[model samples]
Target: MKGKDHFLVAGRITWDFRRLSEEETDWGNKILFLPAAKNMSMLVVESSPWNANDFGIPYPTYFHPAKDSEVFEWQERMRSLERKWLFSFAGAPRPDNPKSIRGQIIDQCRNSKVGKLLECDFRESKCHAPSSIMQMFQGSLFCLQPQGDSYTRRSAFDSMLAGWIPVFFHPGSAYTQYTWHLPKNYTTYSVFIPEDDIRKRNVSIKERLLQIPPEQVKVMRENVINLIPGLIYADPRSELETLKDAFDVSVQAIIDKVTRLRKNMIEGRTEYDNFLEENSWKYALLEEGQREAGGHVWDPFFSKPKPGEDSSSDSNGGTTISADAAKNSWKSEQRDKTQ
Candidate 1:
């Protein structure tokens, strides 16, 4: 940890305080956080760590992943100096929050801001980022997932959920991580003009969405309507808890994982060894490796690796030496964990 400069968590520190469960009385040695937090500064706590998006009555415990899964393994490999925790206090926000992010988006669109841009009231509008997000795939055409303080967020899943397509602010942010499942022209979905371009022109962000093709706009709207069957989960079906079933399931899963980890700890089992076994979060390891190798194979940076009339005969069927190394190690433990 000292040498590698990773997240050094010393003790039970509160990471996601908004939806912490009552059953999760304390921390655990392991937890599964969103992919957005994978490479960030973090720590291991003996008490249970919280997944902010998941919560509800009777608890949605089934879908929570294990601490020793691909997600947690990535975090475990990160190295950082630890910070100590003390005097823990706890409270969670109220449920069915009309103040939730999606609700706010609906409110904004329902209001006249976008319809009449220049005359719109920007000062009176409040920002609508809910502390704990539920998937917005069902009712919304575009799941307005701009960056949250950094490069990525789980809103990509919201895109996948509705297939409404993501509207990214940065072109090179991790949408490729979503791959072909992403709809056509998702680049159009995201506006990539530099921030300087906006400041110099004094453009409002909403005005840009208006310029996108009308056909594409209609397609995004239609996609959200279609995703209703796939992602608008109301499985258990109780009235007051209308949209909360899936969120409940997510919380329940975290509670279950924490319970198992704590029980194993008390019975003298180490979760760390299990933590090492999971290493699959690289989801694009082979693709990235091949891309790197292709660059080097003809690399203007190098000499012999480049192809030539004689090189075809000198090498194996014209495949560069870099190609073999790339394919062989595309799946090594070090590559998977640290790639």
Candidate 2:
């Protein structure tokens, strides 16, 4: 796409940089080459907006936001069956960080009678299935969701999809980052306990969830079920799907952004139009070179009006402009890059 004249596409291609040293301590040589990919993209569809902003790249939307096909099934199955356990945790300890919140939560949760700690031994036992993790969530009223390898964990969403209320230990785990996808007020469906508080044993996750009345917990579970559709990137080929999935929303947003950019350029409000117009002569040269290179006639870079051509003026004769004319400014950029 660099030279073929295509819009740059990017995704959340990296891990949580803030905790990189802790998470990627094993990657001695690879760590140095990781951050070099920053700003190499025009638009990014990422999970953690906090990390996206930290990288200083334009992330228009959050895509493929942690959802699964078995989600509805889990939710339905858990709904009819009474939740047997008060709380549950299924993840292993992050031994890299000696004082990790996950490790602390595991220890504390195991000691408490109200909590169930399932030591996920999938790595050790080939017989252990991943569905067992969902089973744990399904039977629990609340699920302990601490940050895993990254600030964001897929388990939090999995817990919710299982019709269990997620108890988040870190703000980055789900609260501040996923504003576009999650509820504006997080407390509506999930619980937020500061990582510091949880680590220090200052706040008991069980005590807090117990304080939430049964009726409120019912409301929260319903809210979590309702959120499953939007959070999921539904199978596009599935005709049974009618809801707006994450993929549908992200593609629509990209279309809307391009439309807005084209509109602003036509209306002479875009910063690129004038700058490109002043250098319209370069487009002619670029167009000739592109044509020689077997480029298509519909290239956006060659749409600018020549020095004395009819500049698509407004209805009030305020200077005419076409979508072609609007996109003319990009030619110089492409030309410069070609050299």
Candidate 3:
């Protein structure tokens, strides 16, 4: 619906047929969701820049419950608890993918005396509880965070909730992502080790961690703990007037965006309509040739097709060509002209 209702979405959403049930799709327009497969309605909230760029939508925060309630007496205990290990990592191995770095980190932790590996498969009933993981974070100086399945994971935030500094292996793991939630000065509360250094044996995580002074570590830990309340999502039924949590920040962002959009539309309705016609993925999915090809609507990858160019088949059933293919084609044309 245009200019009337807006939708806010969080978490990883996919448009795979196998994941959808027959009943879910059969229901009429009773349900509204953030459009998938490159549909930007100006009403959707995305997860990351990658998702926003791919789908042409605004990004939103992935909210998680604050562990404050679960970890009773955490403030008093965390300050007093002796950190037994230099660093700790608690994640299962993804043996299926050789390129996955979790397996390598597990191996390194196993060999190093300072590294503590708390390996468990969440698929099993016993390993499902977050208590063991929280306890490990409480007893460790730094919590190792490697990107798993996606660029970001809930573990990094969880480690911070326990007042433990996070060590990231990839820029996508933290630095490049979560701009709205995390500080620009990443070193204030987190550590970054280039994945290449770990793979090349150029850096020792244990040695690097040990190099940090106790005072600096204490400061970082304090900052992490202070950030916990903001990063968390409290109960909606309770008053959130004073507390500016992630959910609050995300909702505010959406409101600002919608306000600007509505104002712009009101001032120049014809121009705005034209812009939407050029950029909107506003079409019936079942109807053929309704969607623009080339790329996702409003995405930079899209450009008006050239003379004599024709539409082609794609996996998405859209006439869109891959960005790389378009780049190569443009290069070929330039070379031909030069020749």
* Top TM-score hit: 3
- lDDT (10s digit) by residue, model 2, range 1-339: 122122344443233222223443422122212445332222322232222222112122122323344556644665776788899887767675443667778887888987988785324531144566767777888888876544445567667667788888655456544554676578899887766576655577778889999999999988887876656555445532456655555556556545655676678774232243323222222322242222332222224445787543211111213222112223322433554
Which is the winner by TM-score between candidate 1 and candidate 2?
Answer: 2
- lDDT for 160 in candidate 3 is 78
Clashing residue pairs, backbone N/CA/C < 3 A, model 2: 311-320, 312-320, 312-321, 313-319, 313-320
Note the clash tally of each candidate.
Answer: 16, 5, 1
Estimate the TM-score of every prediction. 0.30, 0.60, 0.62
The candidate 1 region of ten consecutive residues with least summed lDDT is 83-92
Residue 231, model 2: Cα distance from true site in angstroms:
2.4
Question: By lDDT, who's the top model here?
Answer: 3
lDDT of 3 by residue, 123-231 (tens): 3532345777777888888999875554455678777777789998765556544555676677899888765566556477888888889899999888887676666
Return the candidate ranking by lDDT, descending: 3, 2, 1
Every candidate's CA RMSD: 20.5, 18.7, 13.6
